[model samples]
Target chain A: MEQPMTPEASLRLIDEMLQQAKRSFSRMSFYFLLWGALLLVATLTEYAMNRAGLPNGWLGWPILGTLGGIISAVHGSREGRKAGASTFTDRVFMWVWMAFTFTLVIIIISCVQVGQRPGPWVSILTAMPTLISGGILRFRPLILGGVLFWVFGLLALFQWPEHGALLFALALLLGYIVPGFLLKRQEDGLRTA
Target chain B: MAFAPLDPVLHNQLRLAVISLLVAVEEGDFNFLLEKTGATRGNLSVQLTKLKEAGYIAVTKSFKDNYPNTLCRITPQGLSAFEQYVKAIKSYLDK
Candidate 1:
């Protein structure tokens, strides 16, 4: 049975819901924006280093997939449990991180086919995506992972070109592995709590 | 000035569990409430109606993915009720 609500009561309810939604959504917006910009910077830097003849650019593909994988888990384990949906900005950061990482990897693979070494130009191109991912996550784990990967990636560039692959592997593990493990642990604790 | 604690009106564990979960998310889907609170469909439906009648929450029925969705968002009144519940429960510890 439908009981008709007076127009006044209906208006009051709407007003209350709107006000509550505004306050809650606004609080979440600040965090999303802060994380979004950081993701942007990372993606750009990673891409730049790869395009400049870097031999290790192929490694950025799995790295990008890894970032996306982390985002998928994050949405499931953490954000799903949250009070509200992840904002538009947060989704943007996730996609951008994926795009940059994938692009760098594809570029590097193309270069490898030509039997090229990733030069200073290539390394510069590759820096963009790592920087983007680190900035976007805004959590300590990802930030540290990005910085470590970028720094070590750069350092490996200075050594023999052949070692770029090894360096990329190490950086990938550092950038993605540690952070994923940490977040998993945190998610488990939250679930149990 | 501190006010005297009131006795718990809705002592049913299911209702209390629903309230506890809502305090965390501020809003939760009916399915989530049922899952987390471990309440049966009929029990959850009854208790949710009671909470709504008491002005603790506003439940909205909608469709998501062509499936019926029941979303429960806590009202300001509900938040206050949960807060007072905490204070009242804590009075026992205070003694």
Candidate 2:
């Protein structure tokens, strides 16, 4: 026969287990870093090509976007399999990004049909997931990243066409790349500590 | 107020620990629960079976990379029971 736990002990155990589960989902910085770098490269390349009066500059978007999608799929599936367990937080986070991706694709296609730039729309779309993710992770930097996206998004919408790509690139740097690195550092610290 | 009785199925230490973990995550495999609880494999297996039999959790057996895998997920009934248990515990503590 096993001993029974008092209410206090049971409460403590519940708290401890919840903490452990939370830690299990900390390895999420990789996606932010990966997508940020890819988008930054594509945006800068498109901007440079547009400046140099080069043809096919817009091709960078499709090429890099496809590559990012492939990498995200492969990496996400592999990590999911390795995790052995999934949490409600994990499912919610995955759906948020998936919805973002689906809507972004539609926005881009619609913009292309109307011969309009997708920069502002992309920026606006990026903010929601980033902010929601920050709230989910309880990380301030990501939340700030989301706010930066909104600011840059509005700027890209209203500013001159020539500056749209620059603003987009800047948003990726601050909104995705910087916070991505911060999240990675935090996860590393937790692992090592 | 009268004291409500604790659910015997959840009053044991190991069983309660297992349920506590399952309640937090969508699903957890045998290894995950074992790692979190630091219990012997046999002991964890026994407790998992008990919980399953009590309708507190659903257990599924599958394979991963050709290795056997056991996954556990808490049922809605289990969640309701857990909520009741917590309320009961709080009532006792209020005394």
Candidate 3:
């Protein structure tokens, strides 16, 4: 039989578990980057088309939404199947993002119905989850990203509606893509060490 | 002074490790525990059984990718025990 654990050893075991749980969130950046790239592409395409005086420039959004939904579903299932453990922290983060996604969907639908640009609203909505997630994970870059999202979101709201797409695009790149890459790098470092 | 007595079920190194891990996470599969603990398959299996028998944890056997998979989760009883154990150990350290 294995020897009984000393109190010190037991404490160490608990510490290790906490560390592992924190590390489990490393892959979160991948999802952020994925959505960031998708939104960047869609918004930039719309902006270009509009500048070219093309009608139905907004059609790209529906196509992108469909693609995004399919990709998110597949990614979610794949991650779920491969995941080893589900921590309470993990569940909380999942629900936070899920709520964010739902709110974004509602805003998008409302914007379309009312014939208003969804850009500023989307950026503002994105800030809530980003800020909360950063706080949860204690990741500084994500917090900064959240703050920038708010800054750009407000700018998009007050600025020319014609520039809303560009502003939203900037917010995404700052709020998701850049921090996402940093997070990925940190994850890789942890793996190598 | 001697340290506080530890709960026999959670006193063993591997079992303690397993319970400690389960306390942090909602659930962990056999492979996940194996990976985290770096314990042999047989050793992990035995400790899991002990925990399950003590009503400190629950194990579920399921199939994934046409292969058998086992998942383990801590029970409320287990959580309470762990908390008490920690408190006891803390008292000993304070002394």
Candidate 4:
């Protein structure tokens, strides 16, 4: 039998284990970057098409959205297989993002039914997951990214409709792409260290 | 002032380490535990078995990528015991 440890040693052991477990949560920058870039492209394409007086300019969303979904699903499963273990933090992240996706779909469907543009609503909804994810990761960039989403979302809602897509794209760039790359760099540093 | 006795099952160094790790995560694999604890395979297996026997953790055996994989998750009972153990340890330190 192994020797019993003193209370002090036991406490230290617990702290070490907690820290190690925390480090095990793989920071997922790929999803953020991927979705961010895809949304940015889709929004820009929609804006340009509308300016060009092209019919069915809105088709950019459904098409790119489906593509994004497929890529996300594939990437998620690949990452899942590579992970040696699952932490509580990982599960929380999964559920939070899943809830966001669910809510987004509902919002889109509702907007379509009522003939309202889903742009502002989607932007507003994006803030929640981004903010919650930032809080969970304790990453300040993501927290600021979440705030940017809200600011742009409101601007898109009440400001110039013609420029709404531009504001949405700006939010995606700062809120998702920039922070995502920063997070990726941080994860890379940790991995290399 | 009386201090509560530490749970004997969790008093051992290796077992305590294993439980401490388990409490932090949803589930961990045999390799994860072995790597984290730096325990020999035989020793980790023994401690894991003991924890399973104590009903502190649920162990599942499965095959992943054509290799045997053992996953361990803390049970409600295990979490409760761990909480009590922390309280006991705190009380001892407080004294």
TM-score of chain B of each: 0.87, 0.97, 0.94, 0.98
RMSD values, in order shown? 11.9, 2.4, 2.3, 2.7
lDDT string, candidate 1, A46-147, tens digits: 555556765553454446545645755565456444434333444566677567556666766676688665433334554565456556545566667667
User: Candidates' lDDT values, in order?
Assistant: 0.55, 0.88, 0.84, 0.88
Tens digit per residue, CA lDDT, model 3, A27-100: 77877898899999999999999999998888887788778878877887777777778777778878998898
Q: What are the DockQ scores of the candidates, in order?
A: 0.04, 0.63, 0.60, 0.68
**In candidate 4, what are the lDDT values of residues A39-129, reduced to their tens digit?**
9998999899989999887888888888988998888777766666798778888899888988888998899899988888899999999
Q: Please give each candidate's TM-score.
A: 0.51, 0.89, 0.90, 0.86
Q: What is the lDDT of residue A69 in candidate 1?
A: 55
**What DockQ would you assign to candidate 3?**
0.60
Give the lDDT of residue A110 in candidate 3. 98
**Which wins on DockQ, candidate 2 or candidate 3?**
2
TM value for model 3: 0.90
Best-first order by lDDT: 4, 2, 3, 1
**Alpha carbon lDDT at A102, candidate 3:** 84
When 3 and 4 are scored with TM-score, the better candidate is 3
Off by over 4 Å in 2: A1-4, A190-193, B1-4, B90-95
Interface residue Cα RMSD of candidate 2 after superposition? 1.9
